[model samples]
Target chain A: MKKRKQRVNSFMVNGLLLFLCLVWTVPTFGLLMTSFRDRDVVSKTGWWTVFTRPDQAELTLDNYEQVLSGKTITLVDSKGNQQTVKGDNLTRAFLNSLTVSIPAVVIPILIASFAAYGFAWMDFPGRKVFFILVVALLVVPLQISLIPLLRDYGRLELTGTFLAIWLAHTGFGLPLSVYLMYNYISQLPRSIIESAIIDGCSHFGVFWKLILPLSVPAIASLAIFQFLWVWNDLLVALVFIGSKPGVEVLTQRLLYLIGSRGQDWHLLCAGAFISMALPLMVFISLQRYFVRGLLAGSVKG
Target chain B: MAGVRLEKIEKTYPNGFKAVHGIDLDIRDGEFMVLVGPSGCAKSTTLRMVAGLEEISGGKVLIGDRLVNDVEPKDRDIAMVFQNYALYPHMTVYKNMSWVLKLKKKPADEIDRRVRQAADILGLTDMLDRKPKQLSGGQMQRVAVGRAIVRSPKVFLFDEPLSNLDAKLRVQMRVEISRLHTKLKNTMIYVTHDQVEAMTMGDRICVMELGRIKQVDTPTNLYRYPANTFVAGFIGSPSMNIVSARLNFDGDTCYVDSQNLHLRIPDDIGKKVRQYDGKAIYFGIRPEHIHARETNPEAADNFFNMEVSVVENMGNEVYLYFTPGNSQYIARIDPDIPVRSGDSHEMWLDTNYIHLFDGETKENLIYKPKTQ
Candidate 1:
């Protein structure tokens, strides 16, 4: 009787969860349908109305191919003279996103984990003051730095370069990354680190061989956050790399799709998917660590 | 193997809290020295200082004859087992044991040989392929010891390594660690808050409190001759019954007076308390020394009139919670000596073994008999 009762309860919970899931998935279904339909169908009828349309007639990968294969171009003027944009294809923007995100995520995490370890274990002059200062930066909106950072980058002739955006994202993301990693790393057993030291590991050796390995869950989770943040970011790219075509990220490319041609809705879905693909992979791979890391700092036996 | 010597060691944190005051201890080569105390008593801190994990605020720590104050923890060549086992969670039991050897760049076969040897000794051969989480608490603890064993360091530090295990397993691991000490015969410093662990394993025990060493002696000596009231009370379970009393010494006969009991001093040893004439002191004796009057009529030093308040029966012995006159104390009695709450009874005081401490300072005042 108890088992049956629990089963019913679980079934109710699953039903509610599926309902929530469908609520979330509706827009995604529309976008998917929008990407497949001709541009006329996307703006007039709801994408769900294509349900009566045959599978072959409704969904097509042609929008995705055009975006991925760098075939589509945007027309600049209504005189019907087409200016090649390559923005609709998403290839350049996708490559730019990888370039910006890979280093932006890696640099801050590497530096933040070191800072976290130092704050967690090492004793040094002004340790608390430095950590407090870093933590204080978390409250500063990233928008506040956009103009001043761009001005500084322009002086260095760095604005519109990938380096400018990478540096901006790292600076903006570091405080929270350090805070998260510190909370996670500090909760690790002091004994484990001490034991490694006693087992003939130096301080660096302890961090590398013991702490870094032990903190993989925390690292993976933080990487996921930073990766997704930099991947989906357009404002930073716009302010910094907006003038630079070669370095324009997918978020920028998607924005250009709207600004240049108000009617090219097909590229919107393809661009969204192109921008989302890496983050989806990252989220799936590191999702378990995300749950584990969040719980580890709060739960104790 | 080399003995560890701490001369006036101290540890003071930056917050101006002193966790370990100046302490002197000489742990003989190959002897297991246990530092036992209540929590926050600096025993763990002292052990960490020895392992070079904690820096001494003042004083010298020497292993064999070399001062190690400036040496790095890794260079100190010490092994430690932590309270929670501290086995690397990511490593298999075999890898965990062999990691230190591998770090030292020891040859693969030699590392394997040492790892296997430790596993055999710990009965952990079958568990080698498993990670720490895959094994039980006791198994994880063995792997911790195995980690220490493979290093073959000159000193071993154990910081409550068996504390996480269940009761039955703690007793079993206690014996195993003791046996490991005998076989390895390296200088070992084990820290724990458990008096039982201190009693069964230590060759010499250092009792600490707050930030100072109260006493350092063999477990037998510590139990018999605790330097102060705290050591006497802290070292034993059921604790020594300490009651406030007037110790009257009229040069010949020594007597202790309290509202609830009048206890005669036993022969021979009474001479020491005899000098404490007209002085207030704490009269102390272990519960097991106190026996039931009905079963042990001759066991009395002097008789106390009281009713039993409670009784706890263990298979071989009984713990009697009794109040004689108005003083409350526990008297451990033989199993056959039956008494329960609400029953009027008398329990004897083996006066010869009685301990006396200064009423104000709580410093021990009586001289203990020489050990056999």
Candidate 2:
């Protein structure tokens, strides 16, 4: 039953944590480094060399200029019409990622919070059976949902659109979001809910006035989880939205940087960091809600 | 305000555990009734049934003659204060106190007014903006009461609301609840496993055990004349000491023998017990009635010799634990007099205050105390 106090001598524990920190930092570190390094210097030397080569300015305003500059990235469609991608190339893609990910993250969370509140508190017939089925969907791989969801909407002529990808992510994200939220919410004090009922609160009153306010922590943490999942997701987007020609996403743009230019990996790195801005900020800010605020109402004085 | 009536109320859980055997009690409008018992006694279940929280299995529950077994809790016109206080942690004290009014769609100004009034009553006006997490246990409890009072529901149900408070606060709130009863004058049913709360706050206390009403009476009556052996022991502090005795009557004289003690019954008991001359009975007395007295030849009615076992001084009063010829008893005596362990002190029984029960039925054979 003893826990050995970890020391610097215990290299494995410290090393794993150090290694994870390094793993986490290296990419963002690379993106930050690549954003500043000159085009030729970035291609020829690893980002680690900026430390040894004191003569080279790894950081510059020109990389920033080229990245921020509005340039047309063109794609020839099946009928061979060239469409110009608009805005600051990175700025346009940032908007595209926002359009796709925000709704993808929000639609599921909004729907799931209601579903979770219902699953945890409501007493309609077949509710238990349906809730169990919904949670069971958590074990379902998102890849399994992609084809059927895309094909069903594809028949309605909805494929290759952001709506298709958003709906797909919503469907994919809802199961796990509801499952996570259900666990957090089911632990709320029964007495408070019952007292709410006695206090002239209808079920909706309980949901809106009692549950929604109390569920902030659960909803916040779940938002972070679902937001990050949909934001970082490549497969769902790639299958539905990314493969489209004119409406290329940030990940698609980053992917093309590797294929067409192959040497413009710094631009790709810059593009990836721009896409990650919201989720990273959101996860960092709202992460504390996951610590344990839902228990506050349950174990009152 | 509304009175409550439960007619043939029954509760059978989904798991088929029948918690409440059928119970029927009419709680008067604007009166305070307490459902008191040991844990698992179904007193809480009964209260919940009346509160429209627990679904009844049979018969009817009425609030102001309205059949409410099927009414939604919000529509039932009842407010409940939970044992743990069950405050909404995310809400400020003001919001918690104002929730019911807000739910009722009361005007902002009115909700504010009523909440402030409740806060003033509970001495929590300064704590209105704090969440339940930041407040002390007593403060949170006041907010709960505040929530209930804001609704001004036709009835109030308290499920061991004071049990979560400290001993001192529990006693203080006990008095406060009684005062609140007079101020608000709504039908209130309280549930607790603590007998003292039942005795102090209830106008009519229902003492329950194992899903059945053991006894229902006023506190004074329950103390002076418990209906059965269970109530006899359950209602009192330090409990009523009971000893089995064999009754014997010889012409005009009567005696009861309990192995070691052969005591002559008083003329009143000595008269009633005359018919059951050869029957077995229980002899009971409250600790306060047993007194230490100077032996006098003429004071035949009150004298007995005690083999003192332990003397406990609780500052103001001394508790004498002694065996009088084999019957173990406690005597709450004046502390100014010195008594020690292993000393034989002459003690007196206020014989008129003793109780007798039939050993088989456990029913009180004594006449009831006069109504206050």
Candidate 3:
């Protein structure tokens, strides 16, 4: 009876997990199939129809080709006025996203790792109080701070530049980054750190030679999270960079592609997949580190 | 190698708890000193102070005549092996051993030579390419020792390094560490809770309790003449059995009288303890000193008959547990003796090996052995 109950429990758990997986992947699968279909067919039938009606599976690259080619887009405003907005090329927007996200990811992690090591290992006055202050910042919603930050950026005359967006992302990302890195780094055995000190390693030597290399799994996982966050972010870029033609990121470009009517679903699907390509590759390549990093400090070796 | 001198060292936390109370110790050059005590005795705290890992709240710490209280651990030229081994999991054995040399900017070939030499000494050459997680507990322990040996520092501090190993492995590593001390000839300060380790390994042992040093002496001297009741009971395996007794003098003979048993004190020990006549005192006797009456009738001075409560046969010998009056006593006797539970047997106490301690203070009253 016990064995039968266990089997039933396991079966129920597996079924629930499979249902969640399908609920998540089915929409993305539809979007992928829609992105490859001809524009007229995408509007005429649901994406699932391509599996049954083989005629609708006539794949075309015209949506992607037109989106990447860069042309003038006609947008209608709320008052029914037509405005021509020149669409930024997909390739340039992709490069701009890289310019913003890479540093935004790298700079915060670099600063947070140092802050985390100090918070975790070094003894100093007000260490606990300072750490608590940093953690408290985690609860402050970024939405509430955006207007004030944009005002400060305007005062500094740094609006609509890569530096402004990079700095904004870094500021928003630092608290949680430090908190996470501290949790992982502090769990390391104290004797190992002390042994390094006795082994003639100065503080910087210990940080550079020992702590950083040992933290690769954590750093890689943090990189994936930050990269995906900054890449998919539209509000921060739209507020800071203001949808300027040359400085617009992939998300801003995708928003421009949708315009006011939301009639360009086929182009939107193609542009969405294009923007997602890099983050998807990154997550796939570093999935192992992600799992390991989450479990690292929870158990002893 | 240099000696370490801790003069009136004290450690008081910010919250006003004193962990080590004014400890004064001198570890000589090329000597093995073991600081031993039960838990919460501050042995590890003292070792850390010497390693520059803990801040000294009061007094001075000197390494080779240079005051090092303010020096960082990296500049103190000391190596320590923690109880958990603390080998770097990310680095191979070779890298773990050579990282210090690399930090010092030594030539690559020199680093290789020193690492290989230390690894060879520890018999870790075959596994130098493996990481710490790939190694067994004993292997990780050896790598920790090897990492310390590679630096060849002035002093080696070990904080219960063998406590994590299995019982059989602990014994094997104990001999290996003693051999390492002989080969290195460096001043070593080891802290452990096990008195057997202290006895077999230390050139001089410092027994502590409640953050105060109880006694400091050689192993044999500690066994023969413990300065206080705590050391006497702590150092021996079966522990010295202490019971309340009274010392009485009759003409020239001295006798110790308990509630149910009366024992004559040998002349040599009686003379030293005779000043406490008619006074309540604590009498201590080791298990081995008590013999079965049938086997050693000639050595019997204080004879008693008691019902045996339990009998443990230890192959070559037997342990007879019994209650003589209100006090329980264990006697290590011949296994051939037909002693069983509920059976009355005659037992002899060899009075020569007995110890007398002050009833109030528990200090040894009969003898004060000189420490080496």
- TM accuracy, model 2: 0.87
Pairs of residues at least 3 apart in sequence or in different chains that clash in candidate 3: none
> What is the CAPRI rating of model 2's predicted complex?
acceptable
lDDT of 3 by residue, A1-301 (tens): 9999999999999999999999999989988889988867877888888889877588888888878886457789999999987555689999999999999999999999999999999999999999999999999989999899999999999999999999999999999999989988897778888888898887887898778877878898899989999999989999999967789898988887765688788888988988888999999998887665332221134
Off by over 4 Å in 3: A1-9, A71-87, A291-301, B298-301, B323-327, B341-344
Candidate 3, residue A243: the lDDT equals 60
Docking tier of model 3: it is acceptable
Error (Å) of candidate 3 at residue B147 is 1.6
DockQ of each: 0.45, 0.47, 0.40
Q: Higher-lDDT candidate among 1 and 2?
A: 1
lDDT of 1 by residue, B1-372 (tens): 899999899999989998877888888999899999999998999998998888889999999899999998878878888888777877788888998998899999999999999999999999889877777878888888899998888999999988888899999999999999889889999999999999999998888899788888888888888888899999888999888888876557778887777777865767765667888889889997877777666563576767788888888888988765666788888888667688988667777788888888888887543321
What lDDT does each candidate get?
0.83, 0.80, 0.89
TM-scores computed on chain B for all candidates: 0.95, 0.93, 0.97
Models sorted by lDDT, best on top: 3, 1, 2
Give the chain A TM-score for each candidate.
0.88, 0.82, 0.88
Q: How many backbone clashes does candidate 2 have?
A: 0
Candidate 2: stretches off by over 4 Å: A1-24, A70-88, A260-262, A291-301, B107-113, B250-254, B274-280, B293-311, B321-328, B341-351, B368-372
List the candidate 1 regions with Cα displacement exceeding 4 Å.
Answer: A1-14, A52-62, A70-88, A259-261, A291-301, B249-251, B298-301, B324-326, B368-372
Instruction: Summing lDDT over every window of 10 consecutive residues in candidate 2 chain B, give the lowest-scoring window.
Output: B294-303
What would the per-residue lDDT of candidate 3 be over residues B1-372, giving only the tens digit for each residue?
Answer: 899998999999999999999988888999999999999999999999999999999989999999999999988889999888877777888998898888888999999999999999999999989877778888889999998998889999999999988899999999999999999999999999999999999999999998889999889989999998999999987788889889999977999988877999888888888789999999999999988898776764689888999898889998888886678898898888788888999888888899999999999998876643
